[model samples]
Target: MNHDGLRFGNLDYMQIAWSEVTPGEVHASWSGHLTACGESVIKAKPVYDSRVRDITCAECGATAVFDLGTAREKAKAITEKYEATGSLSRADAVSLRETALQTIAPQAFKARRAGDSWNAISSNYLMSTGAATETDGTSILVGRVGLAVIEGLEVSEYQGGY
Candidate 1:
């Protein structure tokens, strides 16, 4: 059926969410999918409904958005920082992961084997950041040169490259 001159027959929702890093701009995300979902941009069509402004995803009738644009830019800055200083704060790593997910880049990566190579070794990013501890182990969220993260990585193995 048609609602307010917008058709819902296609069932493509641009559901998204974002935060105001600054005013007059927004960093948006389409949950993981969007109507015109592209690796670079997101598009939200107005349904003209006061109750539900944008039908990004028809989740039995629910929706939202995210800031992939701002996110990618932030990720780039973080990557650049890591490259220049070979160091990233825990916050930077988290930002990278967030943008990487939005940009469709490799979100899960390990430090390159301690050598001349910049290539990151693939590691398990499925683990929670909180799982690791200072005494028992380090948090995979440890800000390192390689966005270092691990699953059950013992404190002893924490020489810390990736």
Candidate 2:
């Protein structure tokens, strides 16, 4: 697939998707830094480390996650739990997103630092990173970015394919 190139700076995390059949014409994104909490998320190395971080702050120091498949599933489960109980609240939602964010940071970090690589089909491609090398809120790896077509905030077509 061909992409027009996307960039995120000062973005702890981002979720991207297409809005219609027009490919990239209709795009949408949600920020990790501003989602449920104001904290910036970290992308770290190794799945184990990422999982640890997402499960607890002592391990990850982040409040949200991105790109980790397992973490995403867990986040969904958390949301389901909230809905099932009919006790959904702002705090509950925040807590679920926070847990998922923290849990996936390490995996995202590892992906960016290790096995993950960017492939641009166009000649004018310019992939860049605005993250810091240190572990602090001042910096963070870009979180999970997926391509999907959504309608009314509900996923209609997911192009990320995992």
Candidate 3:
């Protein structure tokens, strides 16, 4: 464990890595960085560090992730595509995570209302609900973002209104 009490190989830690294999992505990123490799998810594995300051991959000499369209737009298009063709983009599953939470459980939706003690509540909820990340909030790694669009909210906005 380093100064922050984090160690390599911590699933709860998003490991900073050089993109030796691909572009616009990182290795073992699950340390809860919302914008990781444009994937929006980090798989829990061995790596180093946990502080947010080191979250940027530019430090590793890799191209940073491009924050494309908003989640709502992507969800809409994703659902339409699935409806017409029945195909899914597993690579884009991270986009559906928050929207799905808003669709399914509006009460705990962090985008709208995150009360005090959110970490405790979110951690407990994530573990029990089989959420993808160990971090707080409803950052679920949908793994198949299209499924949530087709099945869950039908690509509707979760927070305020569509």
Candidate 4:
């Protein structure tokens, strides 16, 4: 009856506190009957494991996976381009970022309704452009942006409020 839900990108997974003792027998808090093995499984402890990463959606039967490394790489590339050009305005940067996101996740960026636009659900952050001193007193300029990829898309502008 009571469970937790997790979202990654456009995918969602439910943490149902239940256990299966047989092929057709499942013990959970929602069901009053126990498993065929007579195991009284109630709200069990939720296990967070990478092996069970993907979950099928009950409504549409779609699977979604979250890859942070890929997102970071994309963000880094955008920031590096801005740093190289040195003439990118705020509007241009936002447009570039949104375009990149749309290219990355086309299915997730698909419009759900008529006259809908795909926009970022996450916060837009500015990239850092400064030199860093290493331990050996060497200066290095890295184009880094502590920005996460947009997880969800909506029919609205992501960077409208200035």
Candidate 5:
């Protein structure tokens, strides 16, 4: 049962199926809980070259489409921002994260300082440090700030387990 390079192993977290009767048309189905806060039962038929399609979540009444290129671009931009700033305000962090959620599913970003609380979340994945090496190539005090992307998003929720 070849499925046009689609495999359940790629989406072990959800129940998924597909029928490839025609050469370029594939009908796919998926049902499972998302990593964020919703249940999903999605059906979609996309031609081989299709770039966008919608999926409605049964648990949260949320309807969204998956755009892989856009999501990757957004993620890259967000990552570059963090790499440049090395730190972010709470509002900026949250806003960037929300923007990521618009194109992707169940994404989390986190930033923290050495002595600060870790209660905020973002949508981009990045990490940085303030530590700088001495001119003599000696180790110095470590940096206090850090950033990271926590991966729990259910790509299968939108990809029909692709």
Candidate 6:
């Protein structure tokens, strides 16, 4: 009998919460599903305003346009470790996750195991020193790394370089 379609009666879930790091940066998270949903649809909250100054027309106060390059860069890396017996384990995934969630933004970060993979849903960026307006002030915004992530995945018993 094929037991592949049967529901194993367990679901993997993880979540990160909202917190204020600085005036310009706020951290928040939502529940993530692995077994059922391959990826979580997380609405990206406002990240850093990568602008130094706002340009307006002095003659009539009309809106001006400026070249704003890419808000964030794509950063990704993968690492794998093995046990003494040369078997893939959850620890490797944990280490990879930690390494992946390094910067403030994770546009392309992913870690996979035998049956599960952790991927960054959206762009998470950081704020650098830039210009500001008199009214808006210097309210910068950054992105979220990940929520309360878990590293419990069932992988094969074979170790390989990540």
Model 4 bad stretches (over 4 Å):
1-6, 9-63, 68-73, 107-162
Task: Please give the lDDT score at residue 110 for candidate 6.
Answer: 20
What lDDT does each candidate get? Answer: 0.29, 0.29, 0.35, 0.31, 0.29, 0.21
Question: Which lDDT value does model 2 have at 48?
Answer: 25
TM-score of 6: 0.19
> What is the C-alpha lDDT profile of model 3 across 34-153, one tens digit per residue?
324334443433445533233334311111111112333455654455445545344443335444434333222221133323344344444555664445332333423423322332
| Candidate 4 structure, TM-score to reference | 0.26
The CA-based lDDT of model 6 is what? 0.21
- Best candidate according to lDDT: 3
Cα lDDT of candidate 1 equals: 0.29
What are the per-residue Cα lDDT tens digits for candidate 5 across 1-162?
A: 111223233332223223233223222233332211222324333323322122122111112223333333444455456546756555655555454444223222112111212232321222222123233211111111112212222231243321
Superposed model 2: Cα runs more than 4 Å off: 1-87, 116-162
In the range 56-95, model 2's lDDT, one tens digit per residue, is 2211212122223333444455455555776566576555
Which candidate leads in TM-score? 1
Could you tell me which 10 consecutive residues in candidate 5 have the lowest summed lDDT? 137-146
lDDT string, candidate 6, 1-162, tens digits? 011222111111112212222222212222322111122323323224211121111100000010001111111111222333344345654443444333211221121212223332221212221212122321211122122111111111112221
Model 4 local distance difference test score: 0.31
By TM-score rank, best first, the candidates go: 1, 4, 2, 5, 3, 6
Encode model 4's per-residue lDDT on 29-72: one tens digit a residue: 22223311234555432333211122112111111232333553
Q: Count the backbone clashes (under 3 Å) in each candidate.
A: 18, 12, 4, 0, 3, 6
Give the Cα error of residue 2 in candidate 5, in Å. 24
